[model samples]
Target: MDRGTTDRTLLSPERRRADRTRLIDGVVDVLVIGGGVTGAGAALDAASRGLSVGLLEARDWAAGTSSRSSKLIHGGLRYLEQLAFPLVHEALQERSRLVTTIAPHLVRPLPFLLPLTSPVWQRAYYGAGVALYDALGAALTADRGVPTHRHLSRRAALAEFPGLRRDAIRGAIRYWDAQVDDARHTLAVVRTAAGLGAAALSSARVTALLRDGGDDAAPVVGVRVADLTDGSSFVVRARSVVAATGVWSDDVGEMLGDAAPSLRVRASKGVHLVVPRDAIDGGEFARGASGGVATAGGPDEQRPGLILRTPTSVLFVIPWGEQWIVGTTDTPWRLDRDHPAASSADIGYLLGQVNRVLTRPLTPDRIIGVYAGLRPLLAGEADQTSRLSREHAVVTPAPGLVLVAGGKYTTYRVMAADAVDAATEGLPGVPESRTAQLPLVGAHRWNAVKDAAPDLAAAAGLPEDTVARLLQRHGDQVGAVLALAASDPELARPLPGAPAHLAAEVVHAVTAEGALHLDDVLTRRTRVSITTPHRGTESARAVAELMRGVLGWDDERTDREVAHYEARVAAERESQRMPDDRTADAARLGAPDVRAAV
Candidate 1:
């Protein structure tokens, strides 16, 4: 695509307003509610099938469960123990597609080591399971896009992961899975959908479902949406509507009243802690030093990510830049959906589980960031959230309305395809999903751009590492970002308090990524909020000032935006100190939302 064509497809400020106007003035074939992976995927799928699509989200894209995933694109290994063969097969196929075709730039291979606590039985048990996992993947797709699992001796494993506790395990099993920057991948899906003629709008919430007739049995036709940005309300008409709202599926069902869907969605909160790479002695193992077993950290030996089983859930210490993302506690959460709080107890639990295997125990002081998100698990007789199925269900609660719930992050494309299929049930001539063969916006020319990273870095007067990072994050779209910096030298400078990102990224976030608020740019677009120790407060003012130029914000609005971001950071920190969910939720609620203030 030409520069102008690509720029026109961006979720820019101008494009957002234009799309919103067009959506209100005319009816579309499909209207997708929710900006998370599933909804974005659905929009792309529908638009690819020659359907007129409009996607709306109450907040920024991937602002919910989508952004808070474990960042893995693996078939649930534990599901194999549960005898969920079909689910595992489906996910492995999707993972292959993402790594090989759909989003090669965003999703890549990541190796994981599962320690064997009991020498013989544990090793044999895990080996058999992993062997089956590999077999399933091979059976599903010809292009598996990842290496097979391998067994390692104690000495071999130790050489690959010197950080592992010597007494904790006898050996280990290394396997290949894929990982992604979940938020960025979701955003790219939305952008790709927009490029394919889908009208995408953020900060617009669907409040009510519009029906063809006033009766309860009447088919649903449209939605009444409130623009959270300006407190204005409008109705968008569509032939069909699909709700991929994740944990908020129940809320949308409630809006449907007595005709509500039969599905029950239970919210399970999961939390992750981000810490520096050195804290975990990451990448301490030298390649080819022992038993010829390569470390599973990342493409380079720079990141040797690890995974272990806990009493309640699996714990993953994944490599992400200079830091490792350690997480996840699955527990029932009945608190606020918008800002799920991570209590002191949750943090303590994760630290305790991870510290069991780590040579050095990580304390609260070492934690750089903590994030909590809710999963919309399908309610079943099984009381444990871990027991809930990862398979998704598509329900046509009413005619012209489809509700999709209960799927893992890796299978979002499948969930979206199922949702759209249900939405267009009776409509003739709607083509089958083409997203599996279609590459995301940045993936088309990524390989060429990656090969030219060194040249691009030299021309832009940046380190090759910086150019590589930009390529991984934006793929071939890095040119647009560099173009901004080329015209203004100041935009090339690294952002204060977040040296990994450049100032031009902040500008592009507003101009091309639909970052309307300070929170959107910091939290989702750049990840400064979860990576920096100050939770992005140190850079909030500077980023707000840069955004003001594109957004046309005056001094008063700019100041308020920065203050709101700071308050949010403070509230999140305070919440993390609380003992339980109730107290943590109360603490987090102390911060006022910028939308409400406006």
Candidate 2:
């Protein structure tokens, strides 16, 4: 009733805390650390339950492991071999929820095919395994929407994928899964949490955890936060804390002193290469005759065991918008967790695996982009790193400290729910979680909006493909973007170099979404950084010009943004050429951020 706060907007910074409140009031119901998908999810969960939530990130949103993932949302088929039935089943359930109920706009079913190498027993064994995979999913949800597994004879497989070596495949098997833009999904979760009244700020690191061990271990009270954008510090108090830092969970745990639990999270490095779609001959799902095995999320019938792969991780070649995404080597990592590099060895391994099955081989010259990310694999006894369970844990080390770690990208929601539940242990009358039923910002009534995509396209005077792309990226939010275009027809034009992206989206990222830097908009908001021919460099000037007014960048800042982005692209290109992590990291470090690194 007291209009004490200035900005009443759901996500405005002023609504964060009253001016009278010292940054160190250090008193809130929940203080969530980490800006990955899990941390964002935890903030949304806690805030939705009527808890005073403040989420702090050491870097930009999705800056770490969240942005660097295989970008798939699926029940782990590989888990079946490990006999982790429950984990697989749980992930499958979450996957279904994401596609149908949660974030349909960002997640979609992808198809993949697994070619059979051996002649007889391999085909039967693999077929049965795939049957089990499909049947498991079918029982969990009505109309899982993913097509059932399909079997293909040797001739049929070869006909479907002519790029495959004639002698390599005895037959084939196919299955289905889902894929996503991991970084975008992570940011969406964070933005949705902000919209729900969560105090979410990135580029702010938690320097210390306040412990009142003398007062019956008063629930972790607050955190010392350092603004990475500028050399300033503030104290944010909270009644409870949730640490959802993925591979870096140990750092957060140490802040809790002796109260920190003995938790181990292994880091597994995975690397991917981006190439032009035309560079590799491939089918729609690599099921057409042009490719060896197209891993886009379909059942494979040729192999002994059913396998489902995406263009992002499969041994087969698959197509992205105008490019192809390939390779994913799961190897142990013991270096700086911040910027994982794709070594020449990692690249060679993937190229070798894919080339073994392809009629034409992929060379280094064809690769345009490469990215590497570390997975927070739950540690296990020796000889089991790759097999480590993905089930996340949320443990309270001190009165105010709740540390969460070790979960797959698909199960982030569940991990978040658990972390908030841990943080609200002694809080009075906290409401139950509403995230399960809460559609993300873009998910409301997507069905209706999708049906109207053609009309929207006609109105924008763009091709249907452009409209469909917008719908996939923004869902119902497309209306807001379209309205902006209507006000200024110039906003309706496609961004240079990235024809699929509308100029309005770039403007929207700055004005609405919490994108404070050029990298934020290009790399996360629009994904032009990874999915483009020039890796977003070709469109850098246009994007910088569009943001000139919103970000208040003068000619110098605009030039700095463009120059920074170009250097970044060049560094990434050079990093891809390095033989090992040390060399690769040096190349990447050549382009330091204009602002201080978080």
Q: What is the C-alpha lDDT of each candidate?
A: 0.88, 0.73
Which candidate number would show the highest lDDT if scored against the true structure?
1
Clashing pairs in 1: 297-303, 297-304
Model 1 C-alpha lDDT per residue in residues 29-108, reported as the tens digit of each score: 99999999999999999999999999999988999999998888999888898899999999999998998878877887
By TM-score, the best candidate is 1
Using Cα atoms with residue i matched to residue i, what is each candidate's TM-score against the true structure?
0.97, 0.89
Model 1 C-alpha lDDT versus the unseen true structure:
0.88
Runs in model 2 lying further than 4 Å from the true structure: 1-26, 213-219, 285-318
